[model samples]
Target: MKITYRFLLFFFSCAAFFHPIKNAVAQENWPIKPITMIIPFPPGGVADTVGRPVADALSRSLGQPVIVENRAGAGGGIGMAAVAKAKPDGYTILLALSSISIIPEADKILGKPPSYSLSQLKPIARFTADPTVLVVRSDSPWQNYYQFIDAMRKSPGKYNFGSSGNYGTMHVPMEMLKASQKFFMVHIPYTGAGPAIVGLLGGQVDAVATGPSSIVQYIKAGRVRALAHWGEGRLASLPDVPSFKEMGVPIQFAQWAGLFVPAGTSDFITNKLREASKVASNDEKVRLIINTAGSPIQYLDAPEFKAYWDADAKQMEEAVKKIGKVE
Candidate 1:
């Protein structure tokens, strides 16, 4: 009987050594399958341009295919809703932009609020930051930020500005400016940034509020003049342009984009995704792509990014309450 008991103990000990239930090494082995990155905007836009780079980098890092699928419409709602409804498995993620929170505020203009709230998604990482720029045609009379404001103050509603869409993310800042300045200008909305830029280029609009990427080419060619960047300081790419704050305008807005998975994702999978995203953001290829897109790398880890988003959401809500809807 003693020999049999000793033999049983040895068998159990060997089984325990060979099979561990949970460990760091085991969790690192995640993403056993391909990942689907959903871009909540159409192709040839800012979001799509930035997403491809990170997707390629993630594919190389995880040794699995990372596909970017565009689901445009409803001002990023359709794709975002799809992501929120996807399985909580780490395989699916949404490239959330300022629009993720803006949509709710613009709801009155859109006719209703978004179907899914921020709570529906788990924050993964903040990948990039880009500021909006106030621009005008090269031959326009307004030479600088002050000249533009003086023109507005002297002849209210005489000038007009173009933005990506009606009651969209880019339009919100313009709304705030109009209210604070107590000036008037016809707001023309385009289907997207491309069309809005075309309006400015064709001399159809007096000025525009767009990002560096949309106006980089025109600004470089001297076809358009950058009056000011909507931030605390000048952009690295446009060193000479003054920031709105520096001019004592009290206006500054920067838009950011991040990654998120559907809520209810397991902690193990979420952590794995965060690790993979960090690796992808640092990849050399990703750096080149992001630089070309005109949005510099400003990656924020999970906790910090979440706080940023929360604050941004609160700010948007207040802006909406103050200005009401654009439509």
Candidate 2:
């Protein structure tokens, strides 16, 4: 009987001892297969634009192809929830917008079970935080920012705007404008920003308040007009555009893209990916793609990004509270 008990004790001891070694080996051999980076918004939006470049850069650094999948919906909730529940094996990651902070808070306000919690994800890096611009078709009657707001006030629900989703990054900023400035537009929600932009261009919707990455190309092509932005000063690239602060609109908002992994992912894997992100964001090709789109790279490592994420989440919650249960 003593021999059996000793045997059991020895077995347990070896099991504990080898468990970490097994994990270490697994983490070290990670990306033996391709890694997937999920962009919560569809193609052509800020998330996709930033995500693709980052993915390309990361693939070069990690020696494995980093594939991007667009899982767009629910103000990015569909993709965000998928990544949150994904195996914490580091093969899956989220490249989401600041809307990453909004969806869970919005679910609370809507009295629904949250699709996922902020605690379910860990920040990996922040790639870009660019000011949002308000745009209309170039031929639209409103010639300037002041004229645009004055028209919205006069027309109210007669005019319309489209957004990525109900409480999406794009929608929240417009809602902020509506609440703060005492105006209203018939709000139209699309599955993602790419579709929202399509709606705007097809004349299905009249305006879009969106990240410059999503619209600067269109502006340069003269397909859209940029009357005002949610910044205190003009963008270096779009000098002719006016800012909300300069116009006394009393509201400001910016769209940011950041990376996240599921909680409880092995620390080794997290650090590996984080290091890859640092290298990717600094790559000259990545920098040029982002800068040409009018959002210069604004990279932050994990710890600093978490600090920024926390504060932004708080601000989004407060603003949502004031807006309150938009139907």
Candidate 3:
């Protein structure tokens, strides 16, 4: 009986050892199948513009197709929540935007249960940082940034600015501007940047604070006029337009997009994904697409990205507190 019991114990110990070995081997093999990159915004939007190119580049580097799937709604909360709760096996990832950092504060201000916390997602890398530009229709009387500000200061709440959504990335920066400049403009929130741009063109709103990519072509076509860019310097595509720093606003805002995986994703997989991202960011086609969107390719690896995300989240939180709840 003793000998039989010892045999069983040895067999169980071997099973335990080999089971982990198998799992480790599988993890080393990593993504034996296709991976999904969830954009959390509708197709043809800024997120899609960056997400698709990165996905294609990742597909090439990773030896597997990296498919992009858009899941748009609730100002990007739904898709982020799904990724936060998704399996952390590296198959599912998020192509998150700067808005992801603000959603938590927005939820709190709105008195809603948070969809996902910043802690729920792990940063992989950041690919692009596109500055926000305040733009108006070509025919608008205001030709420069000061003119727009003077108009708003003179008639509080007479002008309105459209944004992708309430408490979104676009909305936050505009609110900061409003707070700093002590001006008032009625806020008109749309479902996404695409819709907000449409509202601006249709005369539903006086101006829109958006990434240049969404309106660069329109600006070139003389359909819209860019007043002030919210960055450290002017965009290469629109050099004549001055940055907010140059205008004495002392505020720099950019709609940066990055890659993230569920928080508990294994280090091996995260490192692999980061390496693939590094390769993708350097791809010539990827650079062209991002540059054409009027966004500079700013890639940061996992640690740097985490630090950047944390700082940005804190800044957004304070900005939201100052702006208060936006109904």
Best TM-score among the predictions, by candidate number? 2
Model 2 vs. true fold: TM: 0.95
RMSD of each: 6.3, 1.9, 2.3
Model 3: CA > 4 A from native: 1-15
**Per-residue alpha-carbon lDDT of model 1 for 73-185, expressed as tens digits?**
66677788898989886788888677788776667545785668778888989888777888999999989888998899899888899866665556777887788777888
Per-residue alpha-carbon lDDT of model 3 for 1-327, expressed as tens digits? 357988999999999999999989999998899999998877756788789999999999999999998888877888889999999999999998899988888898899999999899999999988788899999999999988999999999898998878887678889889988999999998777888888889999999988877788889889999999888876888999999898788887879999999999999999999999999999999999988877768899999989998898888788888888778
Over 4 Å off in model 2, which ranges? Answer: 1-13
Global Cα lDDT for candidate 2: 0.90
Candidate 3 residue-pair clash tally: 0
TM-score order of candidates, top first: 2, 3, 1
Q: Where in model 1 is the C-alpha error above 4 Å? A: 1-33, 108-113
Q: Evaluate candidate 2 by giving its C-alpha RMSD to the native, one decimal.
A: 1.9
Judge candidate 1 against the unseen true structure and give its global Cα lDDT, from 0 to 1.
0.79
Lowest lDDT 10-mer window, candidate 3?
40-49
